[model samples]
Target: MTTPYLLILLVIGLGAGVSSGIFGIGGGILIVPALMYWAKFSQHAAVGTSLAILLPPVGLAAVTEYYRSGNVDLKVAGIVAAGVLVGGWLGASIANQLNGHTLKLVFGLFVLLMGAYLTASAARAI
Candidate 1:
């Protein structure tokens, strides 16, 4: 990749990392939009790449912290994690079958809905 492309990736990565650390949210929320806006990546590509960056170790540190705090519900988490693994694989397979435009539309709608739900929930809590 060119230096400019590498710099863009670095900035995106840094933004995603900081957002994840501060919000306890996945990079998908920030990364996908930034990739589409700044890097001119297709939505499908952004989502796929974001998922690639999120596997395994992303949860390791958080899991350890929870475990140390005696807040790790291993059995519950194990079952949920298993479901997430299966569901994620199935979702990816389905997305892979979709065209770029269709995937972008679907992902965009999903993100909008999620953002609305989160905002509503936060409003309720406050």
Candidate 2:
């Protein structure tokens, strides 16, 4: 890869890691879009790449810190992880059957709706 491409990847990883540490979100919320926009990846490619980068061990450092702070619930996390394994397979199966444009449209709409929901919810709290 060219130096610029490598730099872009570094930035993407840094952004995802920082966001994940702070918000408990990164793979879908940050890395997928970053890969698609900055790295010229297709929606499917971006999703797959994000999943690859987010293998369980990747978050060990953050998890360790959270555990240290008593913010980690092993039981809850284990249960959710089991669901994730099944859901991830199902989601990937569905995604693979979608065309790039359709997948991107769906992804964009999901993000838009989520942003609106979160914004409204936060506004209510404030």
Candidate 3:
């Protein structure tokens, strides 16, 4: 792969990783949006890709099928790993500076917002 493409993937991963570490999440919440906008991935493609990367230990056999079906994006996964490796460090540093109670409150608000969004999206799809 070219350096530019590699760098872009790393950037996507870093951004996702930052939020992942901060919010104690590892998938869809950040990765999906980043992939959709930056990587030009469809929602299902992005989700399947993210799941494949994160759930390998637990769902190797399942993801293997998805990979065969062209649901997984290996390039995106590589980029995510590169970015996550760096972003996780930065996020952990920032999170360490916040008070425990405040962090919990912020996390709670984020969870509520995500739930609302998910609910609305599901309702619309139905």
What are the per-residue Cα lDDT tens digits for candidate 2 across 1-126?
A: 999999999999999898889998899999999999899998999999999998974558889999999998999999999999999999999999999999999998999999999999999999
Q: Residue 116 in candidate 1 has what lDDT?
A: 97
lDDT of 1 by residue, 46-111 (tens): 888888877764677656775898977889989998999999999989999999889878877988
lDDT scores of the candidates, listed in order: 0.82, 0.92, 0.66
In terms of lDDT, which candidate is strongest? Answer: 2
Clash count list over all predictions: 0, 0, 1
Worst 10 residues of 3 by lDDT: 54-63
Best by TM-score: 2
Residue 68 accuracy (lDDT) in model 2: 94
lDDT of 3 by residue, 1-126 (tens): 788768877887776555554554556567665666677775556655766656543235444666788977889978987897698667657756776556546655776898999899999999
